[model samples]
Target: MARDRRPPGRRGLPGLGKLFDMVDFMYLSGWQKFFERRLQRYGSTVFTTPLFTKTVVATDHKAISALFDTIPFIQDYGFGSAVPPKPLVGDVAPSVFETGVLHDNPKAFYFSLLRHRATSLPAVFEEVLREYEVRWASRGRFAWRDEIETFTMDFVLRWILELKFDTAKVRLIYNNIFTNHLWRVARFFPWTRYSRSLRYYGEFVRAIEEASSFEAIMEIARTFGISDRAYVAKQIAFLTGMNSYLGLQNLFKSIVGELSSRADIRSDLDLQLRDAAPGALFSPRVRAVDEFVMEVLRQHPPVFFIFGRAIEDVVLESASGSFDIAKGERLMGVIPFAHDDPEAFPDPASFQPERFQDDEARAKLIWPRGIQERPADTADRTCPGKDVALLLAHAFCTALVTRYQWTVVKPITWDKHRYSLNVAAPMGELEVAGFTIRDERAGRPV
Candidate 1:
């Protein structure tokens, strides 16, 4: 075979580097560091390597921003392959041919519903916060990640379902599907495919399908003229639940942790919320709080990478050079690297919320779908619920600061330079002992 002409990268284990990429994509904790280090070492922002398939990892901020909207680079959900291939539970894959749709209608309906319901989120969040507040205040210190995870799960379920369901049972279902050890282990050992957690995932999917019978969901199905109401419901639930649940947990944890450590930022935040009336408490007229949320997302994006497939042979032109990618090839835009690119973000390493106070600088902050200024759309596969996510985060920050003042039980430190790609480590770094909270208004222990 003629030597494969491609931009060079770490050719992991063997067999076109499939095994290496699999481990790096899944089991490897800080897998993104490998991409970053390789990009830095090879002196190229765009380099080809074997990831789920032959992949071109693009780290240049401008290149990535343009590629997200480019026609050739389309969204790929990794169907009929390893690594969470079956995102839904059904014989009919949720694609154009199978579902007679391409997620546009369903996503549009869901996004509209979520946006319409956005006004109600403040009340919902306050209710959920109160429930946690009682428990957290009584104990004084709780496992930060565990508590926040539960809090987010409750909020997501209630907001999406809007039905009276057992919160604890629903939490169990989500936990088993997402974080259960045995279910994860079963993936490696084929014989253990019958794991109970795996069964629960199936059951959870079915439950979402059954939930279509609810009046709230029926209204969505009726409005969209969707014949397969069950399928639409399942897709909406999966999109809204998993992505928002996981993303919000990280966002919430990071916001709380940041405020705890940075006294100056916290003090500034306190002054901003000082004069808010009850009606304005949830949606405070505050710039610092909103700016702080944007900075957190830029510095520590909840989803590190946005992946897609190349639908046609195309050349990605970056300042580095034009890199060729073949049809059917996989690609990932490293958001962490793009957000930290010096050309885009000055003093990228420092935490500065003020950077976003400017409209031009704020527009540069890109999440998975598109730039901050642009609304998400189905064509680009940008999450439609992007605004809703920001709304909830902003409201949650207001509720948290106004409700209580918190102190870390043990010092929590995050070294982004060393472990930016380690998604699972930050939450654990938040220790349970010695953390305390006090009523901000009353100035007494909660």
Candidate 2:
């Protein structure tokens, strides 16, 4: 099959009628490979008609950096439009994706919620781990992924807003509203499904409002001398639950699956956890967890691509060559490609935690750029929950390694077909066998 080498402008592109076959093919199959191959073939710059959307995908670091730096040349393509009509995050999804403006103040307000004082995620994390230890005490060997999700969901609801419900019931409701029938319906009839999702969204918003007294949360904010509960809620919805849930769930599953398979990595992680003083499950050794988690993220980023629409026509210079991108053109910073670039990260494919061991290597690892660079959580940047997500990933992994002894019950593999947009666990019985480590000092499992 000859490739459609249309010129840069949209006018020369194939019509929907002529493009439907390609669209359907890409939408349903080989999308990740399609993007990966395109990145390889075009040397970090290529155009695709995936989902009938005209998109410019850039795998070049210079291009990605330029896209991040040039404000006028990049715009947020909010979550509502990206994954529209899906329950849990329909058109009303709260994100910079919904609001075009950077909204830095709002982003900061939301970031604060994930921090310790206000929403108490750290405390919640500790409590959940303690509860999980007790729950798995006598089981000896257990499926760790399910337990982790249950714990994470419970913590997110309890500390974030004090939402109360039966754990199983809440999980079932959330799965239905976010993952099960809603996802299937949205796939088949997007418009109707999305509209229905909005109804669920309304219920969720109401529930959140009910769970957390808006006036009281706001008063707490004011007591801290900070106002704006609405903004806080939006931020919380986006960061604390919506964004965090997808990534954390995937991260928990992926990390466990990988640890179960790779004994060396697992042993190293376990040793690090054990070295920590007893009852220090949530302490500084968590940094080791962060490093190991980063390695996993590099291998399998939950969101493989970060995108920004060009705000104005611009030229991005790269080691390979210069490319002219027009205003309104969409640029997808292909994260997997960048992460695998050997120049930035030598031997990118090998699961070597030591790759990030050196301070210099750590500095170059741009998963979350520092303040001098564009903060990964900048309101303008697409991955706003980067810090929060990393923290959660670190905490979750450390808790698992420290509190339990585990082994893979099945081989872990990434399912490219599961979600066209994000990396997900391969469908099947994805299980891990683990036992809570008994700590005699505490007279219970830790």
Candidate 3:
């Protein structure tokens, strides 16, 4: 990683260097704003920055596409923040990447568990959402984002693992997490999030390890060298609890918030569901809901930031100049930035699922193969659980907006600097006055 081959990139906010950049990126929505701006000025190429030990920032389509090819090896550095997680791979679960050294990808087998329950997914989701709706109805007003995270996590754990979690217990963990995050900044949030998720997921790991039907799942985890009880506990908890929690929370927020704000969309969606008949709330034939979900996924991607560290020198050519990224250099692919790339997704910020409703929409796509792509099951590289996630997402929306009418008491306002705490306070609990919904029967703004 010689300095001469590396393109010129800012180290930080002068004097502060990486520290300043970390705060801006992890805390404030710094890089999200800068990725597009920098690409316009710098063109598509890798540039070394103090942000990571050695780093490459690629904002172009080709450069970004090459990154997934390096997956399960180019380990992520939590998107190269100066205050990286102390545990290194503290993301809710222990996957091949989190095990320190990469092995044959375990995700393929890990996702098989979901396949067994695929046929019953919609019914399971309907059950969970119906129960959760009862809870929401009981409460006059509550933090919708906060409660939604809990309900989704509970549903995911139960749906994926067949564990019956007490809703009160789920709410307790979510509440404590929110409390810890409010007192901290960007760097501190991961610690709070992990500790809380770890505490509960620890029990989950043990339960599964002891279960008669779960030895096969444990064997699969063992392939990744997650055999030790302690490691198993963390890994299982992460996989079952934390890993999917973030995505579920984001998807829940985007869909619910959009439906809350857009009466017309809700009306149209409800009409479709009614026409869909009973038990077909999530039917693919329901184009309005399917396209709406796609739009939300594109605009508010579950994993908003992507970071991959190079284990060997990789060559990447750009409009500016070609650069051979030295081993150990970190590469970043801000997914949201790529989605917002004007050339790829014209009117990137607009809510237009129709952009992907036809052949022209396919041309607008920048990512051809990824669970991160529009259609969930299109590619091997796509998230294995994508279809299931979409199914649950549709079930969630149908249970809410499509099944009944509602009113948004107070619209949510997102604080860009909400950072790590975004999970607990996805909309910043302080300002995130959960859209106080009026009683469904009343259908009047409170």
Candidate 4:
């Protein structure tokens, strides 16, 4: 008698039960090796596992794009809700997730926020960068992750929520939640000890609700006949959730690590800074902070993978062959693969700022795609705070590179182990040391 092969989409493997148990136990303990090995073997194809739940993984670009392009067939699965992690700093209340939008139309208010522009984006960039410079000037050898998180939180709050809070308070909030790995773990399992933190979050939200300014803002909206308090609140919550809940720390780590690795890149960046008018380092123009920031994004993309679940069956044409995707099958848009595609980008691995220097390259670069007609965030539900994330990242990177001359204390290595569900980060301390580059002509560090 021959051994039986498990049917597709079924649970449990005959002899691999212990292997499955080990995977569950070490779920958070470095799955990059496994993922990479699987991808190499499968060659950008979809693979399913027989486990407690049916999980599908895709590693191809064309298939991923086809999946994302057909929005109605593929939808954003609210993994955040299933995990129920504690809110990021300044997320005073349960987000739209608690209020029922998590399932209904998780992508609705998020996309709307991306569409609204109160002022010219350049002006907004200027204002935000100026704010970052003020914060960066006061820091001395601080943890890059801590400082960046606080700055990003404030930037998102001020711009999206139209609210203000003390910088120290912002840092305190983020530090308390982010560093508590135990709490983060509790978020994954509802019955865990740290689950009660949700009540505190609720309390915090109620307090914010009582603020006079919040009431006044609501009144202003009503006077304009906006009349939809729930909508406004949801939008605000979405912004809050985006900044606090997403891959912020990982981004800070990647940027600092990458900048520290190449001295030549740093030198060029310093020269760019010195050439700019005093206090004009954060400007949004061709010679301004935005250009340098774009380079950083190209080098170390924050979110490495974008994924969606098919709502209905769809067929995707690829170089290999056409693959039929069933409804609810998870598809991954391999961002790094697209970013490193040589056909799209010549010498993709080499960090060439000049790659984006030409109009042709800029048109082809995926980093700032969907900006003019359909913004990147609008196209998918995966990155809810895409615009805000880019804006904050640009501002933070500009301030660090321009105001402070930093060198990598240790050579920054992009360890594959740190690649989580989204962007990558250092598995351990990614340290850098910097001397201020005050005067480039003098060739002396300040």
Candidate 5:
């Protein structure tokens, strides 16, 4: 097929409208309507101005999938620091990009490590129980949002770091990295939280500097062909700073929001989990928990769209038509759009875990890089922690409902007509506020 030789016309408004769209996008609110309106007016695939730049946004799954799978796209970090500064006190070796040939590629390293660790989820469930036991015992009243955030950080640290260092300090450093740092310079300010984070950051690096302290993780790294102790230490620090803490925290909160509104689904989930044995909760054969998790994810995928820059000239074909994509153009695979496509998802607005019971239906869902069923190891861009994140959510949910009873202090109402910017769910409601829990065993109602 011949390419569309003509230059594409402008999409939506010019000048300030592009800046406005960028602001709405950054806030994760108000931008969906803007995107939807443009897609309706133009086509499934159109070049729209976002962030003061012309970006091709594809709503059709075929176009998005091709953008992800067949066409090559380079990661664009935008203006933010590529990564929060590597521990300032380390050996100061250049990153893999500078080192050129990496024996143990970091991407492959994490993929292999997560895959191997996923097998031990049963033990991870026990850890979840212990963490909750500590929280439930001393608490009289607590905010659901705050508790979930704390729990998420604690869980991720223990699971990934194995608690070899001070958990509190590490959490602080990571929090500062995300919230306080600008151009990665906050560490230089005295008396501020960011400077304090810098101090702990060095201590945290020194602790993991040996790398051999983590025997199991080191073994996997070795198998992947990386044996440098300092290199492993640097990777550990990078992993620690990751904001998966924010991702899982938001995810669980959304789950609670859904549970608050739907008494029927919540009741069923509670009943299924309450009677199941500890081992049963981690069983691959268990469908109830899996179904619930899948549905929530399908409804509220954490990533709205996978963004990348095209590396070559390409033609993207969708239900609407084939469109020419020039080399060096920025492309966004709109995950929410694909998830909501009516042709693929009948009654796409409704929350129904039953849809995922069919393998075919499950295959249609996309989170970031690819469909849920594909192995993360197979793709360079696939989230290595996808399986682990899901497993952690499952274990935590199991612990949350079975061990205690909770009340939604504020009634939850769903607006079926609206949509979420963070989550693609139709309700447009993603917050979990005013929820409280009580210890059922002690007969205490707080």
Candidate 6:
């Protein structure tokens, strides 16, 4: 492949180029909409742009998998060079995908660690969720999105770091840290809340030290050679932020807000839950909840796009042909478009949970990124928590679908517009008017 032979992409003003997105396209539709429209016109699997940096966006699965398969990925997801690679990421284990400290075989190290922990996740998650319900059980209605966000922060902090802070305090701190997104806060100095994010993270570390003998990062430190406890904690905390505002909340809103709106779908969910063993509400035998979670991930995954840069020169192939992306050029996977592609999904944007029931459709749907049999290498930039994420989603929705009747007070859109850039919260504050808890023991709606 020759250099500069790339797929067609939208052109923007010279020097400025698609950087105009911050000002021009933001108000018109959204960041995701701009790419969706362009991909529709271009009809290419991969394309290059001058957005933020020289960007090549791909919507094809093979192209995305090829990008992750390449080793030593440096410029990934966030803007490289413009922002610090990591600030205050202290001493500890490196991430499997984006290495905190690069190594030749860190991928296997993380894969082993993550895989080992998967089994215990089910029991651990159920305990944390029970705590969540006990803490925030209320009458009348409340914004389920905000409630879930608070619950998620607590769940992650307690389960992973064993950092037990007041849930209200955690929400207050996290909200302010991302109050203005990174661009507004991180770019400016004294005005920046970036340091505050670090401070709160450090607080979690302190709390963990005070709270217990077991720290999640300590597992990595003891396993790996690094004694940099602070760094390992920071890295784990950062990645788990996927649940903080990005992955989990987006999923909750889509299911409770959108999917539940269809009376038939809600009935199916109730029937399936009723048939399951009451003792194990979301056991593997209760497969509808599993299918429902997969559909939610397929439609409104936490990330709208996946970004990475070439460590060195690399070739990316598509059904049409092959193109070479030079070292340092950025690449993005436009997940939303690919998830909703009409040909790929029979009724693409229709919120059909039944589509996921077929293994063939599930195989083609690429939003969850990579969670098939071959196993995830730390080298893979795919979401490290993919399996646990699915499990947690199932557990959460099982609780809600089985025990409560939720109604969406306000309409929600899958196009993520509300949360700060750090989070890919797919919907805004989902005002759920009536969330009445019903007795599941009776096997009938209250």
Q: After best superposition, candidate 3 residue 165: deviation in angstroms? A: 3.0
Ranking by lDDT: 1, 5, 6, 2, 3, 4
What TM value does model 5 have? Answer: 0.79
Question: Cα RMSDs of all predictions?
Answer: 4.4, 5.5, 6.0, 6.5, 5.0, 4.1
Across 1-446, the per-residue lDDT of candidate 4 in tens digits comes to 13322112323566485357336433643345554554565564444443224455444445445644565354444535333344532343333333334332434544443445435444655676556645544555545555555655555556555555554543443334433457756677766544444544444345345544466556554543444555545335434644443455556666677667766666676566656643443354334345555556665665555555667766655534566666666665555655565655678778777766676656543442221123554234445555555555564565556556654455566655443322365434544344354443554555
Q: Using lDDT as the measure, which candidate wins?
A: 1
lDDT tens string, model 3, 1-446?
43436665775554577665566566554545545445555554455455534456766555666666544335444322333232322333345333323322456445655666577667777787777766766665576766777777777767666677654544444334423433335334555554555455445556656655466666666755555555554555545554566566777787877777677778777666766654455665576677787777666666654566677776665545667776776776656656666666777867786776766555434322342445433123345566667766777777676444445566655444444434212254322323333344333434
Best by TM-score: 1
- C-alpha lDDT of all candidate models, in order: 0.66, 0.58, 0.57, 0.50, 0.62, 0.60
Q: Higher TM-score: candidate 5 or 6? A: 6
- For every model shown, what is its TM-score relative to the native structure? 0.84, 0.78, 0.75, 0.69, 0.79, 0.81
Kindly report which residue stretches of model 1 are placed more than 4 angstroms away from their true locations once superposed.
1-6, 10-16, 24-29, 82-100, 164-194, 202-213, 276-281, 414-425, 432-446
Name model 5 segments beyond 4 Å from true.
Answer: 4-20, 27-29, 40-45, 50-53, 71-104, 115-120, 164-188, 210-212, 273-279, 411-446
Q: Lowest summed lDDT over 10 consecutive residues: which window, candidate 6?
A: 78-87
Residue-wise C-alpha lDDT for candidate 1, range 315-357, written one tens digit per residue: 7666586667777877778887888888888899999999988
Please report how far candidate 5 places residue 337 from its true position, in Å. 2.9
Q: Write the per-residue lDDT of candidate 6 for residues 307-348, one digit (tens) a residue.
A: 677777777776436878777777777766677666567777
Each model's total of backbone clashes: 2, 3, 5, 1, 0, 4
Residue-by-residue lDDT tens digits, candidate 2, 1-446: 13323223222245663265355345654556766655565554544444335666666555566655667555556554345334454334555555533455555555555453444667767777677777766675566656666776777677767675344544433434433435655556645644444554556556666664456566545544456544555445545445556566776777777776677877687676666654464457555676787788777767666667776666655545666666777776666666777777788878887776666556544453221123556355545557666777777676666556655566777776445422544444555555657552443455
In order of TM-score, best first, we have: 1, 6, 5, 2, 3, 4
